[model samples]
Target: MADITVKVLEPAVSYDLLTLDELKTILGISTTDTSEDALLEMWIDQYSDVIATMCNRVFAREKVQETWRGDLPPQDCARVFLTHYPVVDADIESVTCNGATITDYEIENRSGKLTLFGSWSEPIVVVYSGGYLLPDEAPAALKTATGILVTGARSEMSRSTISGIKSISHRESRVQFFDESGGSSSGAGAIAAAGDTVNALLYKYMRFYV
Candidate 1:
């Protein structure tokens, strides 16, 4: 599994966990106002990438091609794992071993494990789409985490007064926001100081590669 390599055959259409309108709505700003839309858009993209970096995984679903090397005996039909999980089983385009396509296999969607019915000495290649669809299908907790980051970035850049305010409320939605002077103004520092809720939300999504 050390030699297993995963490549994005087709990148996701949108990596942003929070849309511009969502960010505006969270900040209690009018969505029709274009004054700070550019800045907010930049934060959305930047903080989205930062969230992905912190999580060590991409939440947006994308088409990927993975090459897995043999770690078991040639005759042993062992179960192998894929890099990206929650695999779109029906969207699995192809599975080939040593240049030959094989269908004698089973895919475990949630675990991203594949159990080949036949034995093979060569490497296996799997082309499939995996992960959440972003903004649209992204989990609520993840969306909240993204909002926190983007809001923190906004707070740091704005000259508005939010000294003791712990959260910002807009309509029926409320987002947790840290004080700018609380030592986590922006960037990775903000992620580190994101407190228990953000940490807990990101914990399950963190990827550990061995």
Candidate 2:
């Protein structure tokens, strides 16, 4: 596989996976409370980005132009992977081999696979739009993960001690402990270290390319 170059033709969805009202409700804030509106909005954006990064997938729909070095897969399959998925729709704007436009191709939207009919020149370029078009279209697991993260962050903020401090006393005590047990403790048990339950939920959304 050659290096793939991707460019976003349109920005990803501007709205968050969780609406302000939803987040406020989860945080137990009264609907009339506007004081923390801005702060909550910031947290939503930050956590959304974090989830996408960790999952190696984009949650919002957007248009993108991608280019890859021409190469066919093993077993004679002329397929290539697109940047994001599950693709919103198989609405490919254009397909180009080198500089000439080609039309004989098929798209597997959910998997981001593009199968070209015949061999082409050096670089294969494709322009398309993919991903969930609306927040409601996002998988329920993703939304639930976002909620967990937001709730955990809010709880951390309410603590009077320093952010990571486990205890506050005169005697020297470890604020953060590492368990060498290498059991579940190394996994979900380390929620704060690995972003709570979000990563586990995001596993299904992960996208891979060859």
Candidate 3:
């Protein structure tokens, strides 16, 4: 699988152009030409302070989750089970490929690059949406997420608030968020007779959205 890297850059052909404020917000920056390492160090230092404000401010909205904790409408069995909490900068992080398999590698600094990493053991299905890579690791606090959803119009900018299993990219479209978990029996989407199982998951999403 191609190493999928989601970057929020300027519009390619001129469809979506980010506003100044939106770009600033996404940058989480205040206009500076500081060294990348210096910026990263500052961000790492402020990670917690920013994340606290975000969990309450940015993501503050109606939310709910229906996993094994809730009842399944069709079979009444556990709809989805969380194998484990996705870890960041750790042994078991999600690859850009929507982790259906697992492996180990030493975490090294490809620091010469801008990145955010995430990994999930089980693939989660979203309704009117799709699966997401848990945004466990971020460059800064404002970039982190709580895996919750926000109702109403969600613009491209207001992303940390719009939630699911967590994703690194806020500007997610078909091209951006490719369901690489295709043809798998389990993980994110499971096979079911008459598609009831998928429908059931969708139903969970509807409830969350509504």
The local distance difference test score of each candidate is 0.78, 0.73, 0.26
In the range 119-141, model 2's lDDT, one tens digit per residue, is: 66658888888877656676788
TM-score for each model: 0.76, 0.76, 0.16
lDDT of 3: 0.26
Compare candidates 2 and 3 on lDDT and give the better one.
Answer: 2
As a whole number from 0 to 100, the lDDT of residue 171 in candidate 3 is: 58
Worst 10 residues of 2 by lDDT: 181-190
Question: Among all windows of ten consecutive residues in candidate 3, which has the lowest summed lDDT?
Answer: 144-153
Candidate 2's displacement at residue 177, Å, is 21
Clashing pairs in 2: 88-131
Better of 1 and 2 by lDDT: 1
lDDT of 3 by residue, 1-210 (tens): 111112222211211112223333454545453434353343333432333332221111111221222232233211232111121243222322133432322222221111222343222221111111212222222231211110111222243344333335445542233343444566332122224432332332221210
- Considering lDDT, where higher is better, how would the candidates rank from best to worst? 1, 2, 3
Give the clashing residue pairs of candidate 3, or none: 94-118, 94-119, 123-187, 123-188
